[model samples]
Target: MGERAYNFGAGPAMMPDAVIERVAREWQDFRGEGYSAMELGHRSEHFADILARAKADLRALLDVPESHHILFLHGGATPHFAMVPLNLAQPGESADYIHTGYWSDKAMAEASALVNVRIAASAADSEFDRVPDRAGWQLDPAAAYVHICSNETIGGVEYDGDPDTGNVPLVADMSSNILSRPIDVARYGLIYAGAQKNIGPAGLAIVIVRDDLLERVRAGVPSVMKYARHVEWDSMYNTPAAFAIWVAGLVFEHVRKAGGVTEMARISVEKAQKIYAAIDASSLYINRIQPASRSRMNVPFFLREPRLEQRFLDGARRRGLLNLKGHRATGGMRASLYNAMPLAGAQALADYMTEFERKNG
Candidate 1:
């Protein structure tokens, strides 16, 4: 029971203190039942209630419409890269993709193996410093759907708002930024997020899909890969991730009590601004992404002296900040300011940055 570090890892990120405390309190016997949530069978009545409440709370927080289905599926966003193309596009039909950064590029690469994938827009020319402007997108009129990684966890680029995709369905891989802001659920045809970032833990992903898209799933696709199967079975086609779902349910409830997505968005902006401002004001650090497209959830910055990268991380750890190292592909520091990272944590990180710079600058 030592004090927890201010975690800054990209996924399996921080959870609210309140949620963690609650989970600890109920670990042995959930709601007076004689078994832990992890021990309960997925099909048990108690587990069913947990699943229902989790979905209901999430729907309320996101304002998901009745026309849409909320599914808690196993596997993270990587699976969806393949599943999306298999379910949505026909043999000859292509899907459009906006390649903003690493994750988006990965998505396109995976989908290209299964179906026709058209690069409607890409920010590779700029080293993914910003999202390509909507006006610059060369979208196909006959594309089955348009896919975008709303936020790039590695490159730290994010779309400020929803892209206008015209009649085609807009699908977003919102893994890092989902529930960090208020989004109009109806605007996107499909949105999926791995639970590790803003939701709960690893091993579960939440998929929100519009009803009409279920009808378009390729007939030969495996039942497990079909959105319709998950929807029909209430996301429990087989044994679900019971413990992860229960924890996620607790998180959803916590979010509601904390004033929902609007409040989360407000705090997210505040946290990101604090860190970005510290980086901008310093001669010792740099955030390469354009201001407009900077991610509120993941802030990747580089030290002026790359040699000090390890020292910076070591110092951060000793100061009670942890997981501040950047991704291997992008060698620098990345502070993921997810919803669970309080304003105080961001401020602490800023203070550490300032002090560290003064000593080493």
Candidate 2:
């Protein structure tokens, strides 16, 4: 049998081998139901149980408070960029945004069309190498919410702790680091993430909106984009993503049995530290983000000699290390150490980085 290669893609990244194996066993005849999970009716009692269990397990995993409703929506995190303002703010009202990197920029661009998007703080002058200090942020007291990308997948900068927004709602797009560690759910008004990273496959987005925030949906917003409508229907206002939800349920179960997010964080810290230590020791590579702000999930580093980039990637692929390329906007290398990435995988990559430097640099 061929071995599975370590995957380091930023999104739709990787899944636990146990989860993948369980899917194989259920693919043709799911739990003796005589049909594939993909073909099950979303409204059927069978699927209802699946949906309910998924929600229960996720809530247990994250310690999601009863005040926040979790909704499984269709589009990825991009849709929430617009939905956040549409549901939370009135026409012409301001919403504060913390500009950290590429994903943060995209969120503001879409939100600008819906409300008076305000750049409360930005790290643009540093080329997004670090998140702006929260104390320097010029927040709007009248703003609907304060937005921040908890983890900048492209630049590899992540907030170590949630910023205090005082009375204003603190909204975060946690697409890249949602389940990697434990979080204080009561601290935020809303949190949304695309399922492709730590949750499941490509077809779902998870929205955790505080119940009171649902009552703030602006007039004339479509039911599809309205948070309250989905909350009323329990994420089944329309058909839910049945297959993805099923898989996510298994993932939630797997993570819970694996000691939940607390254990995941310990392992994540070790994995990222291995790679970052290798980069720091080598003169041939560099990661520009400030050390304190560096991400434990995505490690984006660069080879000192740009000419050797292609050769480095080619050599890594030969060793069963895959998807090491960085985002196209910024050319270099990125290694996403999601929850599924084993510590051995990170150690392997770190070892390769050292050997590659010895040979080429």
Candidate 3:
């Protein structure tokens, strides 16, 4: 604890200490080999084995079915905003998008360029402080697919559970909360996540897509963007992000050892409750989001007395609580307690909040 600080950045965030230590030890000569993981060719036998082990671990952890294909892709989830439409939505056909937060808005914007777009549901009227009820979604009967951002990082809203979108295939961007809880992979036609929050480092994204979706690719979609091509070539259609995928695999193993997603979900709820209770009890701070729709992964709050914002951040930093500042657009303090953040860290932050209120109130 001497040098380590509680990190709360939204993405490219904290990683498990066990993973970091192991990487440091074996980075130079992985598995008794002479070359570092970064220097090895993507096609080398050693790297191939590393990737296979990773995918195997992931498939086991998430309970992914044999009917689904897993791919380690290059671009972040940002690119899939456009790629999803290009592959699934033909020019005349429309796609349904749920506008839950900033990310969903961006996803719809990208989709609009390629196909007819329909906003099936939106929380814009609420300023994204809460998730709209599932019953309120305005679904289209003839859309190509239904897309939703499973968790909205910037707006501090998350779906408590998956939604049933009728016979329409559901596509989800679960970037911030992928392994934070258990998910039924069979329910989704496609699940994509940028591996920086609960998974691993940046430069890698994990996509679990159903086998039927492969044949539906609209012609002329970029080869690099097509899910079919990646599945056909085993995500080796081009040079993969070797090191990032390796780290993701290691993270998958770590989650499995910790008792898989069900256990992770239990811990996630406990961690969130610890901090949320402190926020609610304190007269000096307020979290605007609805408790039921609140995000367990990212908690955004504001001091009752705005003048103490700087003091609160500075004092927390001195105490080794770091990166608790909110998103600039939102203008408040956000504590992003991802999977790597221990319950002890949340309790520590809660203690610091009590102390700060005592002094400043």
Best by lDDT: 2
Candidate 2 residue-wise lDDT at 97: 98
Kindly provide the TM-score of model 3 when superposed on the true structure, using C-alpha atoms: 0.97
**Which has the better TM-score: candidate 2, or candidate 3?**
2
Tens digit of lDDT per residue, candidate 3, span 12-54?
Answer: 8989888988888778987778878678688889778888998
Q: Point out the higher-scoring one by lDDT: 1 or 3.
A: 1
**lDDT tens digits, residue span 214-280, model 2:** 8899999999999999999998888888899989989999999999999999999999999999999
lDDT of 3: 0.88
- Model 1, backbone clash pairs (residues 3+ apart or across chains), number: 0
lDDT of each: 0.93, 0.93, 0.88
Model 3 lDDT at residue 225: 89
Tell me the lDDT of model 3 at 197: 92
lDDT of 2 at 144: 97
What RMSD value applies to candidate 2? 0.9
Q: Worst 10-residue stretch by lDDT in candidate 2?
A: 37-46
